[model samples]
Target: MTTQIDRLTTSGWSTCEPIAALVRSRGLPAITREYLLAEFSPETWERAEDATHALAKHFAGARFADEVEYGVLLVPDPHFLDTRRALPTELRGGDVVDERLPAGVALPATRPWQLVVSVIGSYGPSLGSYNEVTASDDFVVLGQDTRQWMTRQVWGARVLQCGATPPDCEHNERWTFTLFPGEELVDGQAESGTVLKGKVRFRLGKPNRGIGSARVAPALLIDVQ
Candidate 1:
């Protein structure tokens, strides 16, 4: 229990793995803290296989081997619909006013800090299902399966604040929530790729009313532009 000269002392990388000899006997820094804590395997993925062809060409057709199968699925950065990125002053300019717009022209109103969005993995296994009947006056009917699993065009983040809001949001009462990134991107019933868009920051707390604003704290995806 006496080895912390700021880690990094695995004696020039060469693992026989006892967790790299217990992180080189606790002195730490064992192979640069096991690749800065990625803690790889598959025999340590050659320590990072030169980042698998640039993360497989930025996740093109994802579904690699050692990992990444229906993972890495972030969306919301389609240049933010290119309206100079401040959309939402009631949709400024392109104001067709929600007839699902697209008649003339004038489309730049999506602000709320562009509403935010992200996934970076997991566009699978969400399909839909939930049932519970009892009707005929006994009343119980629950039926669920709306079909927005994730991946269609890629837009549907909704977590506007825990269990549908109600004095919640203490970081979602510990279970935490916050997604924001919607307005378009939905075409992912499954089968499609590349959905990267970054720059995240949350630790929210103010704003209330069933959580209509200022609440973001569930993830921390940082500056990924």
Candidate 2:
């Protein structure tokens, strides 16, 4: 019997060439595409297409102000670390340890889908400024809950210390965080909703004075119907 993976791969709707090209250009492994195909449902692919198209249109003629590397990942499960470990050595750029899920939170049995948009590399001055310009488009709207979670949870946990000795500190090399959908659990209940997850990796060092940054952050405007 032809497996679901085989059917999806041969169905002409498994992969988006433009998106795949972008992912490959950023040095993401082929397995990223594999996961997208095997895990993401058909509806999820449609949303990805819409989000990518909107992002392309938004940045049509804009000059980037940062050296940004971004990729889109559709995770069918909430366990991101497991997904990371399954990646090829070259693609698993860094490791996240001792991460913890929220207490008293119960995830759904049928893994709720997660759309992860990762922005890696250097930002010209600050990520906030970059986001202001790039994510200002109407297509990209961060829900209130999502915004709060990013501020309090994601940014609050600095996996690497990048603020002690200016650019020279080894700890200042990289600062990263993974953003999960806010309100995963609310009012003592878990609801089934398409989760939007974002992973951002910032490379901190001497400010890139005079050298402008290339911005390629892709925002997900998911419309789950």
Candidate 3:
């Protein structure tokens, strides 16, 4: 099977070359990032009218940043600990209609889609008031000229403390989504069968008294309908 990464590599677009490199990197074991990167065309980059403002809006004054280390190393999926969402159909649909549907709930006919990675962190001064901070990839949604996609915030995480730095803490969550078929990125041109893939990394600053911080690394894969 020629994977999404393969198609993107053969596309010969220089913009996707970095994504190819990341796919080739050994440290990361996942391949979803390649799909999103391949979908990112020069046109998409150009259409990002206010890049600075868009990014600022996404960050929302969060003073934390995450660096791409080795590969797109994300925390374990909220449910599976070390597993990622299943590929293909399962990620998008299922037999039963549960109470709360997962992020990438496939829609009927056609619809816009988005994959989001959210990071949340909180700190307390003397264990009383924990100031919360967060950052996420929804900024991409905000930058879009078209507001058609039914977006969802899939993954989130609290900063992981390497050691005993705080008196108390909580486990952060990381999520994944397989969006329905639609044109959220390509815009108007009707990229129905197009799948977009990309990763978002965010970090949060420490609190004043009680230590608090968080980071989220998300790789969102959308179906190229």
Candidate 4:
């Protein structure tokens, strides 16, 4: 009995997992693994989600940062928290029309999907100039040539595998964050500016197989901020 929200979340997560897994791997101490291993509950997921955004905000600003020495470090960063609606499915002739369906509640064929991860201490000294966005493979890279990147890497290969064929050479690839201004090798040899804007860009990856398996998440461009 998949509830409406269940149908929405499960689908979105399936599409997001693979990409999220890879991006989440880039954190200083690593946190994505912990999230993946934990039980999948509405309460638990929400907690993890909030922590990601918090961490992002902590590290996103212009400042030096570090990690907590003990316990599973939980940070919140909206860039690391991906959420969107699910697509509509083919109705099997008869559908269950119930009280659960609110009056005039028009369910769209699809909803938004997201893939995000947070990192602490990733944007510090070593980050240098041009802003470095260190992210987990779990989070999708959303920027630059957004359309083309999605066409080949995500929509075509990552999501539409169809099971009959193997993953495309470009499918399930890792993310590469670009350093716009290029890291300043010298201490006092660079311009002063916010290296990291509201977002960063890179390729995306997948989650561990233990979770449900599916594909195709909502497309997010520069929305991580």
Candidate 5:
């Protein structure tokens, strides 16, 4: 019998065809195409496709890695409480840091035109002693340094000093960042389109001590029309 998890996994991988199709249509690099198929979740790929299609009018004739500015946001899955435990170890950490909000916060009904791809995963339990999320050039180009551009904050009310309590003790943490496009003169008019790439790094609590895991999505392409 095919279990629910099995179905989900299979369904996710099934996106390979669409991804491949996008690669061929966009004339994207074969290596980046394979990287996206291998590393990101089905959810990310779906959003990527939507973003690409939506921006087709604006990015026409522009090469993906050479002329497009890509932006990727690592978003916590809103439904994590219901599926976390059952998710594969790799998909577990994208939870919201704010425990105060009730369950069932819906995903945005409409896709934002400016967004490239929102990478979904289990990112929380925010109550960990140490939490860190970083983005770099290996996968994507961050407009600024990891420490400067990345925003980190403690969310929960309870505070536990390091070494005062057990290392396993949990604490709430929230992380955020932004990306911008570069502009140049196009036929004497300002045009936006600068080549870039994106990737993510996440760490919670002590080394190898967190309950969740994360995966880096493909190089996201942002449409700055």
Candidate 6:
């Protein structure tokens, strides 16, 4: 507990919270140790605030506080065909085989990357529930309520990894994960704001929204870009 150097602060700065203090003590984010480990100084703290805004801008998406309500109590007839409800059974141009197109034969194939979401946060009284899905097919059930809860496009998404593959088939094991700015948020669902695009373990502490991704922690960073 003894120091290498005296602490740097006025009575105000010491008693008053540092800019990144909330981010450090609260919420789930992409913040690495490096992000919070810089020397504490007036200039350094100011720079951190700016860095936080930049990180939010480049990596995170806009949040929507639900002003509008979207849901249907009506269940459509199983026999009824709604044009909007139906989509093309298959998508074109998704496979590597397209690179080998011959002069004669044409194959239409588009495979989807598996979309999996591990429940990172919760609503409706503390950390509400834990849900996990391995494929988009299963996601369909939760998509409606989940989308409504998130209330913004891009899923208000915290991108887990860009094009990386999971180390295992399990959604609870991840190869990579990232935290971004505004992760300092203290609302009921800040922990859930995160999206796991690849396999990773997601666990939450009860009665409060707390998500812990299982496995490795990479060299954490905030992309200045």
Task: Give me the candidate number with maximum lDDT.
Answer: 2
In order, what lDDT does every prediction score? Answer: 0.23, 0.30, 0.25, 0.24, 0.24, 0.21
**Cα RMSD, each candidate:** 20.8, 12.9, 15.0, 20.8, 18.4, 21.3
Q: Return the top candidate by TM-score.
A: 2
> Model 3, 119: alpha-carbon shift in Å?
8.9
Among all windows of 10 consecutive residues in model 2, the one with the lowest summed lDDT is 156-165
State the lDDT of candidate 3 residue by residue for 78-134, as single tens digits: 332211122223222221222222333222222122222222112211111112111
Q: What is the TM-score of each candidate against the true structure?
A: 0.17, 0.34, 0.25, 0.20, 0.19, 0.17
What local lDDT score does residue 90 receive in model 5, on the 0 to 100 scale? 27
**Candidate 3, lDDT over the whole model:** 0.25
Provide the lDDT at 157 for model 2.
16
For model 4, state the Cα shift of residue 30 in Å: 24
Q: For residues 34-92, write the lDDT of model 4, one tens digit per residue.
A: 33333234554454445444434433332223321101112122233211111112211
By lDDT, highest first, what's the ranking?
2, 3, 5, 4, 1, 6
Q: Is candidate 1 or candidate 2 better by lDDT?
A: 2
| RMSD, candidate 5, Å | 18.4
lDDT value, candidate 1, whole model: 0.23
Span of 10 residues, lowest total lDDT, candidate 6:
105-114
Residue-level lDDT of model 6, residues 9-67, one tens digit each, is: 21111223331242233332222233223322344344434433332232222121111
lDDT of 1 by residue, 132-158 (tens): 101112111122111222221222222
State which candidate, 1 or 5, has the greater lDDT: 5
